[model samples]
Target: MEKPWTKSVTLALEGPGKYVTISNTTEASWAMIEDWPLDDAPALNRALDICAAAVEGKRPAEDARKAFIEAAVEADIEIRE
Candidate 1:
């Protein structure tokens, strides 16, 4: 099983005030695969790979978090601090 991150990544979706918080590798993986608005992107693919590695204990959760943020930016999604 995957462990939760030190801090959650909050992002705003398409609509105003709508938000989703991804707190772990699993949630990040799901969001990228299912909830992401873009069909395909380099950053998205990198995030998916990083998330998978993190879940398998091959990479740090922080790496996944950074990759997720990059993917969100590539998709033009708004990330909240």
Candidate 2:
């Protein structure tokens, strides 16, 4: 029951040149669990939980999106507008 966010979040995955666009809870979760560079962090854990909740239909996808952004910031990842 994964849900898509109203807007997508773009992150610079391999520095400023490369990027990944996450548009839904599932993508966010995958990015956090599989592609994230940091081993662990408070914001990363929070984002994982929120993404799970969003996929389970217990929370809005936008919540997961916000959490993902926070996690990205915590990991020193660049967020593109």
Candidate 3:
């Protein structure tokens, strides 16, 4: 079976690599924003990969969130004040 939210995820690379946005276009839409730092590209890629795996049922959503959070921490992306 297919995952409902799989189709809602989109990737937007901005301004010749100024930033990246991974958005969920569903009714309960949400997004993950990553600013350009070049080095952070791998972290973003890792998070996206985890999300894809979760959508495919190869991984759990909680695991995905953990991976994403770790990526953000490794990238030093200040997501909260």
Candidate 4:
């Protein structure tokens, strides 16, 4: 017997000032979103929204990636993953 393949989304926001990362990958890791600052609201919300749209199949992964990059650029935030 073999294990079935599965996918999942991992959202994590570390210490203050760190840009939240939304990693879409196989079910290999799990994380929780917590301790986010109020100032990071807009960008964080947008990221979550984009992730939601992508997971729901409302948008292609590439399109979502582009959107994420665009939003990050607009906010002057650097994406590391």
lDDT by residue for model 4 (1-81), tens:
212223222223454355455544111112213333333546545655665676676755555455444544454444453
Better of 1 and 3 by lDDT: 1
lDDT of prediction 3: 0.47
Candidate closer to the true structure by TM-score (higher is better), 1 or 4: 1
Put down candidate 2 lDDT per residue, 1-81, tens digits, no spaces: 444689999999766769989888888888888889997899999999998887787888888899999999999999989
Instruction: Give the range of the ten consecutive residues with the poorest summed lDDT in model 4.
Output: 25-34
What TM-score goes with each of the models?
A: 0.91, 0.91, 0.47, 0.40
lDDT (Cα, tens digit) per residue for candidate 3, span 1-81: 333433222222233324433323111112334343344367666766776777666876665665565565565554431
Q: How much does candidate 3 score in TM-score? A: 0.47
Q: List the residue pairs that clash in candidate 4.
A: none
Q: Which stretches of candidate 4 lie over 4 Å from their true place?
A: 1-22, 25-48, 79-81
lDDT by residue (tens digit), candidate 1, 1-81: 566899999998655479988898899999888889987899999999998998888999999999999999999898889
Report how far residue 76 has shifted in candidate 4, in Å.
0.7
lDDT of each: 0.89, 0.87, 0.47, 0.42
